[model samples]
Target chain A: MPAEPPVLEPQFATAEQQRSASVLGMWVFLATEVLLFGGIITAFLATRVFYPHEFERAAGRLNVLIGGINTVVLLASGLGMALAVHAAQKGQRWATLTWLGLTALLGLGFLGLKGYEYFADWRDGLVPRTDGFDPGDVTPGRLTLFMLFYFVLTGLHAVHLSVGLGLVSWLAVRVMRGELPRAGATVAEVVGLYWHFVDVVWIILLPVLYLSGHHEAADLHF
Target chain B: MTERTVSPVATVLTFAALVVLSLTTVGLSFLRMGPAGHLAVGLSIGALKAGLVALVFMHLVRSPGRTWLAAGLGLAWLSILVVLTLSDYLTRHVLPS
Candidate 1:
């Protein structure tokens, strides 16, 4: 059976035109997202410049092993998403759904690891602005500032990942109903863009948040 | 939009590179790099990984000029924010008291 062409919206003269518009809109939205996270990152960097030792010490307390594993997990998920988009473009519905399912699972795995890491942080008394908060050897004030940045950055990232997970799962449902790879390829492509962007954010976060300090402890436990 | 397809080979290669780069960043942290050294190395590796993701995984290379413009504009604005903010913060102690 021949693939059905996407329904052209009344405002757009051609299907091609409408698809481009949708993609462009998504990219523009992603650009604004860049600035939103970028602003917080800038503030973190400036604060680090002021008290490098405190920040590094604080970062050292973070669980690098978890962060490192999540980086690879997210990267693998990105591969799944890229493959899903490729399959969708070829009009392979089953392939698209399979890849999408795997992608969402990997995303869930990332969040799971992140949640475990957070729990470990709580056990370690690293959560800032709490009665049980422990600054260790670092100054309490600067360490609290660093912890605030950590929680804010990672918390926002988890929120974005959760959103991406919802989008991917929705695409999977559409693919199952045969609504995708025929008329919904653009939608898949757009969600793929969002998923990869989230992975990119995590990639950037890994180094900034987890790897900027000396790791004297060689144990990967917790 | 043109339906450009990335080969699975290329996609896998990008993923491998990203994983390798991630490990490299972590490994570098074990060294006794001073604060600036650690930040520079970590962020440099990070910037490289981000570039790969943007160009390959994000499909920026195959995207049209308008899309490129949007990505570029985002980077430009981010640069302005970082440069301006750091200038003041990094230079406050430059003048002899």
Candidate 2:
């Protein structure tokens, strides 16, 4: 009989049991998270049903190029996170740290790009009810509502990204200190679930917020 | 001896597929599909990308049935909320005075 790892509570007979319990707990939590964002998405859809043209026109004003770049940035971050989990499972502490560091860096880069995009939107007077508001052809009030959704959705996603950064940073430090090996790889894998959940949110947001608007089609030839 | 870890190559491949699909969705959005078609294409692709991340990057594919149940429950509830709400709003003839 091999000794159980420290991560195994007395309630669990084996490390594998402990890991499955923890992972299942995370999934349960994520299910609630899906609804947290789902409510807002449902509301957005309902609003669109009433003002489809205005919403589409409002969406057109968004910067799709920047959104596309951010999507790629987020996807790259997911890749780093996945690799980090792989390294952690292999018990390669330094490799785990390296990959996790890369993940956090990419996450920060995504935030930077998001900040710049927000600033550009501010400059374009996209913020509703501001003195320099630009409503384009869309009704100002309805456009404001659309922009409201944009800010709220992206802002919520940004908050999640920041939380993920904190989590990844903490994981990296633990990896460097050789603390995570004692617990096996469950901690890192759990954190990866949260990180990838955030990425999934952004993946959904990109199309709804950035691509739905009928702004001029992006010229791919360039 | 019993860890179920995804390969780095497989992770990289999944990332590549996600990126390519994203670009394809963006390109498809430019095709002047009417609003319904446009949204359907973009959202369908978005769902696809999200599924990839959940399954591969999050390692849900190898996860236990309990985890799948938890995840599925969330989506099932979301569907109930969305469908019920849409049905109510879409079928309503007029607002109360």
Candidate 3:
């Protein structure tokens, strides 16, 4: 009789099963991440509903140019991360590291742009304290609250981006040493999950912050 | 032997979808819809774009159905949290006046 492989030996299984397990596990982890981002979104929604005019007025003053450029920058960084994964899968280690480094640079550019935006916000009296802002036609309490949410949510996102950059940097080192794990796509797969989630947050932010001003300030919302 | 191919075509398609969704949402903003319309359009386009990213680039659709199950359940739980918590917050200041 021919020898049979043991049941516990995953090496004997087809690639399809391995890929499926990785996907499922990654999804479960993503679910948890969704909740994290979801909380911030919920808070944003709640506050925005109660203070529509205040949010509209405050959001109108924001520089769409910065927001728009950051959006493109983030999207490109995400693309680079995706390509790095593809290169790693194809066993092009140098190509993978190069893409990773590009992604890191993009990420840094994003943070740098975001930093300038924040500084502008601070200088323009957009801070949350009742005394932090100038005399505009907004409810002082509500306007301050909107700025608070802006800082907390976007600031938290920046923190996550910083961590993501660090993760990619480490992955870049792995690629350099030719030690990119044979576990194949899981690392790229997981980081991609995080990257997409971050992008998703910005997707919501774009409308609420940048586009909210397009309509009348009194427009009722929830 | 197993093979791993870099799917430039699929990635390009996803990028196209992202761009389209972004444009669609922005165009919708110009329409004078009340708050409901704004919310509906923004969220709808956002959902579609996020779905594209998840499915094509993240390979959610290419993976096993179990992955969807895991993700869907989490989203469901999250919605419940949002609903219940918002219900409490909304009603807290109401009915007492």
Deviation of model 2 at A210, angstroms: 0.9
Deviation in Å, model 3, residue A59 alpha carbon: 2.2
Say which docking band candidate 2 falls in. medium
CA deviation > 4 Å runs, candidate 1: A1-4, A130-137, B1-3
**Error at B83, model 1, angstroms:** 0.6
What ranking of all candidate models by lDDT puts the best one first? 1, 2, 3
Interface RMSD of each: 1.2, 1.3, 3.4
lDDT of 3 by residue, A16-86 (tens): 56655665676787788788878887887777767777776666566666776777788777778888888
Candidate 1 per-residue lDDT, tens place, B1-97, comes to 4646677888899999998998889888888888788888988999999899888887887888999998899899999999999998999899745
The digit string of per-residue lDDT tens for model 2 on A1-222 reads: 122346558899887788888888889898999998999988988888888887887777788878888899999989999998998887888888889989999999999989998998887777876344565555678878888999999999999999999998888777776765556478898999999999999998987887887657542211
TM-score of each: 0.95, 0.93, 0.83
Q: What is the DockQ of each candidate?
A: 0.79, 0.74, 0.42
**Across residues A107-211, which tens digit of lDDT does each residue of candidate 1 receive?**
999999999999998888787854545656667888878889999999999999999999998888877777765566889989999999998888888878888
Better of 2 and 3 by lDDT: 2
Ranking by TM-score: 1, 2, 3
